[model samples]
Target: MSTTTLPDVRVARDEQIAGALALALAASLAVQNAVVIWVGAPSYADPMTEVLAFHADHRSAVAIAVGLEALNLPLLLGLLVCMVGLVERRGGAGAAWSRLAVAAGAVLSAVFALYAVLWIGVVLAADGLTEPTPLLELVWQMHAGAFALVMPALGTTFVAVALATHAGGLTAPWQRWLGLAGGGLLVVAGTACLPIADGSSLLFVGMPGYAAWLVWLIATGVRLVRSAS
Candidate 1:
């Protein structure tokens, strides 16, 4: 007896479409998410802190940002799985186990998103709902878990995956590098929180990286969108 297998063109196309959209969404979301982090991690000692800082004072924005973080996992994972699904259906094409990269990013992004909610909640709910005291609350917030540390790990990992898969694809090498670096910053910024969460110290060291990473991803997404169109 002989077994026959056929390619599901419809499924393949759907996966491609999903992958593209997810990439675009991830890019857009990264920028928005970073803005929220900056806003959420605002310090009281500085004037900018009292102004853009919302975690201690603005529950609504905190909640909104937190909610966005929560969605990171599903969106990332869905994109990754679909991306992988496309790879498999096409052939043993790209890098080995590229899906693992997606998995790393999806899992890590999810974890970070979840903890973002927890951390923000802790900051908002602090008993000493004032300027200086509430500032310390942010410090206590870092130890919540190594979630911050892992997010960057995932971000960088996803960057690698994107590069590997695009080894010869239409994506420009420069764009790929930009994404890889952005993802790296996400992880680095999160990890640096390990030592200091006291007053926005993480912002100085990590925000630039995180911000760059987001911008890079957003740029890549724009390229992808433009290409598709």
Candidate 2:
């Protein structure tokens, strides 16, 4: 008698499906964040307006920042999902370093991303409880922007590592490009938000890159959905 074990096709299929899901989530979050910028930035587009606004009530100013920063949660989640999907592929592939790299970075960065969101919540709740001051204003905005910086930094690293580990050709080229371009644009766009008072205008600068990545993600999701059948 002879016996053989069947390969774990279920796990393999799930991993592929997850990669596509993560891509779609990231793209949707990016677009949603851009929408908020479009809705809110016009009110404080002028540098002088921003300065004046910040003086009014650190609460309100931080309010705007908080709302915008909210987007980071989903973006980071998507990044983690994408990283996991990519890392999962290496489970028994002998690329221990690559798998570990993405996982460790995902955990480290997700912490900051979550902290960034919670900080805004703290500031928001503190609005009536504490007095608003320039120092506090700077504290929130500076930190908000700071977290934004680190997020994309680590996010991009994850993308690079994932792309390095991913084994596919032009047929699935969008996934790799989305990972690279999405993460890159996020870093650039987040940095650009620092220079301009109106994150909206600056966000448009990233629209092309964002759109490219977004479409890539949606397409990936569609592919996965179809594959499931």
Candidate 3:
């Protein structure tokens, strides 16, 4: 009996940790988006000069967003580790999906890291430049492309984790469906990543998907926390 109870306690603890990490990740991303919106960030269709000016004028805000992203990557990885462990321990059927989630989450983290670094470079380079140089445009484009590519990686993680957890009976049918829909949209948007990087309107397709993901994160986090309680 003691042995059985010990394992239960550990599972509960892991769930709590995962829930907290999920909430934190969502909050961090929300704050970053708020900062970007508050700064009136230029759209992709905007001139490169306007983009350069925005970065130069709002260096501090951009830096803060980058800092939050740095924090978010580790939180994401932690949540993935916890979720994968929980799924594997609870249901063997989900093992394959959990593995896929891990792979995709790893890619997502690496891509996000690159995105943050590129933003940092942009901020640093914008320090005193009055106009956008060819080099600046190149770095900015790379940064944009990196961000666009992140959508597909994120989509894969979302779908895999949702399916894995559902197989483990850790998520409801609604949650599973939501994840699938959102993930699918993101994947579709990723197919046009080059255009998205160029500031095409196709990028809008992923915006709702990303918002759905945030909602899913918060809802799932709540469910996990309540289950632990």
> Please, what are the lDDT tens digits per residue for candidate 1 over residues 1-229?
6443234446535545654655655654765566666655544234423533454566666666667665666666665555565555545465554656675775677567656755665555553455435444444444334445655666666576566446525346675666666666666666655454333455445555555544544554455456444
Write down the lDDT that model 2 would get: 0.50
lDDT of each: 0.56, 0.50, 0.89
Q: Say which candidate scores most in TM-score.
A: 3
Which regions of candidate 3 are displaced past 4 Å? 1-4
lDDT of 3 by residue, 11-49 (tens): 999999999999999999999999999989987778988
Candidate 3 TM-score, true structure as reference: 0.96
Worst 10-residue lDDT window, candidate 1 = 44-53
**TM-score of each candidate structure, all chains considered together:** 0.67, 0.55, 0.96
- Model 2 Cα lDDT, one tens digit per residue, 1-229: 6443234465446545655654655654565456545545323233433433433445454455455445545554554454445455545342453455456456645555564565565454344433545554454455445544554555455455446445422126556666666667765865764753222365445456555555654565565545544
Best by lDDT: 3
From the highest lDDT down, the ranking of the candidates is: 3, 1, 2
